[model samples]
Each structure stands twice: as C-alpha cells, then as structure tokens.
Target: MKIIRKSDPVNLRRTVDQGTVEQRKIVQSIIQDVKENGDQAVLSYTERFDGVKLVDYKVTSEEFEEAYDSLDGEYVQILKEAADNIRAFHEKQSTKSWFDTQSNGTILGQKITPIDAAGVYVPGGTAAYPSSVFMNIIPAQVAGVERIVMVTPPGKDGKVPAGVLLSAHILGVEDVYKVGGAQAVAALAYGTESIQAVDKITGPGNVFVALAKREVFGDVDIDMIAGPSEIAVLADDTAEAAEVAGDLLSQAEHDARSSSVLVTTSSSLAEQVQSEVEKQLADLPREEIARKSVEDYGMIILCETWDEAVDTINEIAPEHLEIITEDPFQELGKIKHAGAIFLGPYSSEPVGDYFAGPNHVLPTNGTARFSSPLNVDDFVKKSSVISYSAQAMKENADKIARFARLEGLEAHARAVEIRKERWKS
Candidate 1:
C-alpha cells in the first residue's frame, strides 16, 4: 500500500466513476437482444458467457429438495438462524399506510405499497454467496412483496450450486433461474417466456451485471449501480494495528479495484498498520487479488489532526467505515457519509456483512454521500394521498389556478377553475 500525506490531494470522485465505454456498448447490445429475441437471446448468451447449455432455466422443486438434502444439517440450521436474524431486523424498517385528517375536510398521507415482484441477481462465478440470498430476499419479504425471483449463472454442468438453491428454498423462493450476467438482468427487466418480468432488481454482480442494471434502470427499478467494495478504517494510537490491517484486507479481497484506506492522526500508527497489512496479505487465500487491490487503490494516509482525518473520511464516503479510536463513539458523531459504520476494534465489518441484522447490500464507490444502504424501504413504493372536500376545493382552487397559470399550464389552471366553479354553488 502507498503512504499518502495530508498535503496530497485525493480525487475520490474520479476513481468512483470508472466505467469503460466499450463495456457499456456491449451491455447495451445484450439488453437489446434480450428485448427483441426474448428467451432465445437469454439462452444463447447464457451458453456463450457461462459455458453452459440448459434445457430448462428454472429450478424445479426436485432440484430444491436435492440441494437441501445435499447440504449438511449444521449448515442448514445456520442458514435458518441467519434468515431469522435478517427478517427480524428488516421488520423494524417496514412501514405502514398512514393518513392525516384536517378540520377543513382534507386528508393527506403516504400509502406504502410493496412492489408486486422483485428479481435478485446473485453471482455464481468465482464464489457462492448464500448470505446474499438472505440479505436480498428478507427485506423484500418484510416489505410484503408477494413474488420474489432470483437469477444466477449455472455451472458448466448446468446446475446451480447446492448452497445457493438451498438458501432460496429455506426462504420459500421457488422461482430460481439458471441465468446470469447481463442476460439475467435483461430477462428480469424485460420478461421472457420462461422468466416473468419483475418490478425491481437488486443484488451485486460483476461489471457486466452492473452495466446491465444501469441500462435497464428506467424500465425497472434497481437498488443502485454498485461499484467495487471498499473499506476505510480511522484509527488512533490506541487502535490495534493488526486488527485494523485485517479489516482493510477484508474488503480488499473482494476485488482488484476494491479500495482499502487508513486515515490516522498518529504517523507511527499509520506505519504500523501499513506493515501489518503486508504481513497479513501473505497468508490470505486471495492474496493475488488483495495484493493488487492494496498496491493500486489502498493507502495509508497521515492526517495532522483528528478533524483532518474525519474530513478526509467524509470526502471519500467509503462503503464501510470503521473507527478504532480510544473513543470511537466520539468520532461517530462527526461522520456524515458512510454506508455502514463499525465502532471500536470488536465491531468488525464482516459482522454486518453476514450474521448481523443490517442488510449487507450497501452503496459503494462514494455513492454513500447521497444514497443509502438497502433496507425494507427499497422493496416498497410510496404513493402520496391527497383528498379535498367540496368546501376545501372551493377555498383553495383559485390559489391552485393561479399557481398553475404562473407555469403557463392553461389546462391545469382550467381544471382547477372548473372544480372551483362547481363547488362555489
């Protein structure tokens, strides 16, 4: 990792919006093919990209049963426990339809309605993430979404991983499809003969999947265009250098472009953390990926003071922020932008990633500055409720007409004028 002093200017915005023009073009072509050709395009792309040919794309009940049987008793039990934890946490975020009545016979409020159906894309290439299934599905369930579909690339044998299938089965999600990459995204956005279209799409995927989501955003609602995972640790002299290093590597191993940063007031602590990162990277299984990530995007930044460190963290707006100072809560009040905050050494980032109740799907690549973490709200739609009695319309119609006329919308003004004339009698 590189050591950067506070004097150097950090351009985090530029680093976050790193997408190739060629990638966008390719993703656009795939989306168009899916929109035009439907299931055939999905099948062809699945074969070409995933190196697998499938007779049927949907996972049958027998497949689910087989997957459940394949897994050990202990792992299945753990998944159930994790699902309960996720459901309980998201249930707190669930909202209800509320209304307010006024003395003048006006009723206004927000009506909360869950999207009819939602699709989640889980990557099946290098790793299998059963945890993602729990995180994505539980929130939608809590929001009262009736139909939840999942899409993932199948292996060369044309079979989804047993763990992935088992996770879906545990959640009672039957519509698991054996398609992935940009094609799966297209299928979710534009309905295929086999896989029905969904109102919204969510989950993490590769660059192709991310670009596909960006392309299909308007056709269907998406969570966010997530980038590479990142973590920033703000430490002081009291922090353990080894623990800080471990937390940085936790995100670094996610991808070659993942950013891991450490901003500290103590120069000695900064040096110690940097050394600890190097020492730990040698033993990691994903050493090559983590090493490249650390060498390129990782940094040990030396700040002159605690305030400077906090300012730098806000500018970065990292996906995950860990404060390992003597008084971590004191520093927490100063943090304004971060997807998830981990306080103290004991509160590691992984706890939120898997077992903890908070949704692991977080905004990445400086997006936390404006967006938010995935929660029950992401699965639901809100409609503004507005009702006015005859007297209330008569009282406010002239003002509404005047406001509409200011915008040169004559028809809008006339509509209000007509209602006002009717109520005046």
Candidate 2:
C-alpha cells in the first residue's frame, strides 16, 4: 500500500481520477449506435459480448415464475429479509405533497410526486449481487414510482442468473429484459420495440455502462456515474486492526480500481492494520484483486492528531467512511462529507451494502464531496404549489409590481398591474 504523510491534498485527486478521455469516446460511439439501431444493435452487442444470441429481449413472466420456484428457499428468504429492511429504511424518507393556506388566503407549499417510470440496470458480469437489486428497487417502490423496469445481461446459456431472477421476483419487478451494456442504457433512454423508455435509470455497472448513462443523462435521468467501491476507516489506538483490515479489504475486493485508505493518528494502529490487511488478504478469495487494489490505490496516512485525520478525510471525501475509534459517535460531528458514514466498529460498509436500511449505491471518485447515496428522494420530485385568492393577489400585487419595475421587467410589472386594477375594486 502507498503511504503518504499528511501534507498533500492535490495528490488525492490525482490518484482517483484514472479513466481516460478515449474510454469515454468509445462508450459514446456505442451509445449512439444503439440509439439509432435499437433492438438490432442491442442484440448484436449482446451476442458479441456475452456470447449468447437473444431472440427475445424481455424476460417473460413464466421465466420469473420458473426461476422463483427453482431458487433455494434459503437464498430466497435472504432476499425477502433484505428487501424488507430496504423498504423500511426508504419508507421513512417517503414524503407527501403538502400545502398550507392562511385566512388571508394564499396556498403555497411543495408537492412531492414520484416519477412515471424508473429503470434499474443490474450488472450481470463477474457475479450476481441480489443485494444491489433490493437497494435500487425498494427506494423507487417506496417513492411510489409507477413502474420499475430492470435490465441485466444474460449468461452464455441465454438466461439471466438465478439470483438475478429470484431478486426480480422478490421485488415484484414484472418488466425485466435480458439486454445489457451501453445498448441497454440506450434502449432504456429511447424505447425499443420491446423495452420501454424510462424516466430515470439507477444502479452500478462496469465502465461502459457508466459512460453510457452519462451519455443518456439528458434523455433520461440517472442515479450517478459510480466509479468504484471505496472505504475510509478512521482509527486510533483503541480500534481493532483486524476489523479495520477486513473492512478495507471488503472494498478492495470489489474491483482493481476500488480504493481503500486508512487515516489514523496512532502510528502503532496504522502499522498493525497494514499487517492485518496483508494477513487477511492472504485468505481472501479475491486476493489478487485486493492485492492489486492495495498496491495501486490503498493508503495508510499517519496523521499527527485525530483532528488532522478528520481534515484529511474531508478532503478525500470517501464513498464509505468507518469510524472505528473509542468513541465513534463523538467523532461523527467532525465528518462533513461522505456518501455514507458507518458509525462504530460494528457498522461496517457491508452492513449498509447488504442488510442495513440505507441504499448501498453511493458516490465514488471523490464525488462524496457533492453527491449522495441513492434514496427515495432520487425517485421523487417536488413541484412548487402556489395558489392565490383574489384578495391575496390584490394585497401582494403592489409589492410584486414594484419589485418587477425595479428589475426593469416591464411585462412582469404589467401582468401584476393588470390583475391589480380588477382585484382592487
């Protein structure tokens, strides 16, 4: 792992922004082709990449039913439990459109409305993550989205993964398609003969998928361009190095681009955690991936004090921040920017990713400084509700007219003046 002293801020930015302009251009070309050709392009890309010829794009209801029946009871039950937790967590974030009216009579408030349709793109390469299904779908469900359309790439056998099917079944996702990659994104943005267009698309995927989403953003909204999994553990002498190491490795195993950094004030704890990461990584199934991640992007920055460590963390703006100190709750106030803050040693990144109510989909590549985790809010939009009685309009008309005239908006002033003369009498 790379070790740097606490003096550099620009170094962090340089380390994280690794993707090139050429990659983005290549993805852009693919997106445009799919947009133009529709299902033909989607099918061709699917056959080329996945090595499966798809006759049908959408997964039929019978397929979901058969998959649900075929799945093991144990795994199915886990999906249900996780979905329940996700639903509950996002339920709290659900809001209703409300209006307030005074006797003088102006009704002004905000109306929260769910989007018409939401698209969820679940990654099918590498492995099937049922957890991601729950995280992406439940929030839109909670927000009362009319329909949730899911897209996943099929395997060599021309079928989606059993876990992916089971997850779709558990969430009651009726519309699922076997299409994936930039073509799937294009299909979702501009409806094909089979797959319907969606208002917003959400989930994590490979670089091509992210780049496609970026291209289709104006045509359809997207959750975020997720870079890679990242975790920052803030530790001191009191924290357990093994737990810290495990947490760091958990993120590292996600992808080679994944970053895992440990910012600590205690030199002894930093040394212990580094040793522990090496020891634990040896036993990991994804050891090579984690090793490369640690070798390339990982860091153990020795801070002079806890306050300095916190400042460093804010600058890093990690996607996942774990407070593994003696009093983690006390340190919570110091953390200003992070996608999700895992408080205490027990609250690890996996907890939020799998079981915890919060959505695991988070901002990465230092975007935690601005972006946030996916939630019910992303599925819903607020519209300003304004109503004025004749008396109310008359009372406020002079003020409106005066302000408009001050801004040299003659038409704006005239509109209020036209209403004023009639309402005044």
Candidate 3:
C-alpha cells in the first residue's frame, strides 16, 4: 500500500469506465434477446455463460428439501437466527398509510403501499452469498410485498448452491430461478412465460449485471448501481495496527478493484498498519486479488490532525468506515458520509456484512454522498391523497384557477371552474 501525506492529490472517482463498447453491446443484446425471445433466450444464455443446461429454471420443492438435508443442523439454525434478526430490524422500518382531515372538509394524506412483486438477484458460481439472500429479500417481506422472486446462476452441474437455496427456503421465498447475470436482470424486468415481471429489482452483481440494471432502471426500480466494495479506516495512535490491517483486507479481498484506505493523524500508526497489512496478506486465500487492490487503490494517508482525517473520509464517502480511536463515538458526528459506520475495535465490518441485523447492501462508489442503503422504503411506493369537499372547493377555486391559468393550463382552470360553479349553485 502506498503511504502519502494529506497534501497529495487523489482522484476519488469510483465511477470509472466499467466495461468496453463490446461488453455493453453484449449486455444490450442479452437484454433484447430476453425481452423478445423470453424463456428460450434465458435458457440459451444460461448455457452459454454458466455452462449449465437446465430443463427447469425454478427451484422445486424437492430441491428445497435437498438443500435443507445437505446443510448441517447447526448451520441451518444459524441461518434461522440471522433471518429473525433481519426481520426484527426491518419491521421497525415498516410504515403505515395515514391521512389528516381538516375542519374545512378537506382530506390530505399519504398512502404507503408495497409493490406487488420484487425481484432479487444473487450471484452464483464461485461467489455464492447466502447473506445477500437475507439482505435483499427481508426488506421486501417487511414492506409486505406480495411476491419476492429470486434469480441466481447455477453451477456447471446446473445446481444453485445448497447454501443459497437453503437461505431462500428458510426465508419462505420459494420463487427462485437458476439464472444470473444480465439475462436474469432482463428476465426480472421484462418477464418471460416462466417468470413474471417484477415491480423492482434489488441486489448486486458483476459489471454486466450493473449495466443491465442501469439499462432497465426506468422500467423497474433498482436499489442502486453498486460499485466495488471499499473501506476507509480513521484511526489514531490508540488504534491497533493488526486489527486495522485485518479490517482493511476484509474489503480488499472482495475484488481487485476494491479500495482499502487508512487515514490517520499519527504517522507511526500509518507505517505500522501498512506493514501489518503486508504480513496479513501473505496468509489470505485471495492474496493475489487483495494484494493488487492494496497496491493499486489502497493508501495510508497521514493527516496532520483528526479533523483532516474526518474530512478525507467524508470526501471519499467509502462504503464502510471504521473508527478505531480512543473514543470512537466522538468521531461519529464528524462522519457525514459513509454507507455504514463501524465504531471501536470490536465492531468489524464483517459483523454488519453477515449477522448484525442491519442491511449489508450499501451504497458504493461516492454514491454514499447522495444514495442510501437498501431498505423497506426501496420496495414500497407512496401516493398523495387529496380530497376536496364542496365548501373547500368554493373557498379555494379562485386561487387554484388563477395558478393553473398562470401556467397556461386552461383545461386545469376549467376543471376547477366547473367544480366551483357547481358548489355556488
């Protein structure tokens, strides 16, 4: 990892070009094929990309039973416990429809309604994350979505991972399909004979999937265009070098493009953490990917003061931020932009990633500056409710008509004028 002074210029744009023209062309073609050819196109793309030929794409009851039988009893229990925690946290985020009535006989309110169906995409193959199954689905469930459809790629053997299947089954989500990548996204958005269209799509995937979500955004709502995972550790002399290095590497190992940065006021701590990261990387299973991440994107920034470190972190707006200082909470208010904040030494990034009840699907890139983590709000839509009584219309007709006439919407003025005339009579 490179060590630099705070004065050094850094380009923090995480929205770098993700693919070439050819890759986008292929993704667009896949989307078009899925839209036009439906289930057949989905099957053909599954064979070509995942190298798996499937007779049926949906997960059957027999397969669900097999998934349950394959996992150990203890691991299954853990998954259940995680689901409970996820459900409990999201239930607190559920909202209700409400209305306010005035003495003038006007009713003004907002109605919150869950989307009819939601499609969640989970990546398969070498990267099968059951945790993602919970993070993506539980929110929709909490919001009372009628249907939750899940899509994931099958392995070369044409089977979804037992863990992913088990997680879906545990959550009572039975509508899972063995398809992934841009094709799965297209299927969710446009729908096929086998898979019905969804109101929204949420989850993470590779470059093609991200681009696919971008393309189908207006047709269906998406959580966010997530970029590579990133972490920024703000520490001082009080922070432990080994723990900091371990936490940084946790995100770095996620992808080669992942960035792990350490912003510290103490130069000694910066050097120590850099050395610790090198020592720990040697033993990591994904050493090559993590090493490249550290070498290319990772940095130890030496800030002259704590405020400078906080400013640097806010500027980066990292996906995850860890504060390992004497008083972590003291820095909490200072951090204005971060997808998730992990405080103190014990609060590692993985805790939130796996079991801690909070949604792990977070905003990436610099989007933390504007966007938010996936939540129940992502699966629900709100409609404004307005009811005007005869008396109320008589009281406000002139104001409404004049405002409409100012905008040159004469039809709108006439609509209000007719109501006003009826009320006067």
lDDT of each: 0.90, 0.87, 0.91
What lDDT tens digits, residue by residue, belong to model 3 across residues 1-425? 98999899877657734688898899999999999999999999999998888878998999999989999999999999999998899999989999999999899999999999999999765577999999999999999999999999898888888999999998899999999999999999999999999989999988999989988999999898878889999998999899999999999998898999999999899899989999999999999999999999999999987788889999999889999989999889988899999999999999888888889999988889998889999999999999988788888889999999999999999998887556545
Candidate 1 similarity to native, TM-score: 0.96
Candidate 3 ranges with C-alpha deviation above 4 Å: 16-18
What's the candidate order when arranged by decreasing lDDT?
Answer: 3, 1, 2
lDDT of 1: 0.90
**lDDT preference between candidates 1 and 2, better one:** 1
Cα lDDT of model 1 by residue, 1-425, tens digit = 88888888867542444359998899999999999999999999988999988778999999998898898999999888888888889999888999999999999999999999999998888778899899999999999999999999999988999988998998999899999999999999999999889999999999999989988998899999888889999999999888999999999998898999999888888888889999999899999999999998999999888889999999899999999988999988899999999998899999888887898899888888899999999999999999888778878888999999999999999998876556546
Q: Over 4 Å off in model 1, which ranges?
A: 14-18, 423-425
Candidate 2 Cα lDDT to native = 0.87
lDDT of 2 by residue, 274-386 (tens): 89999998889989899999999899998887789999899889899999888999989989889999988789889988888888898888888888999999999999999
Predicted model with the maximum lDDT: 3
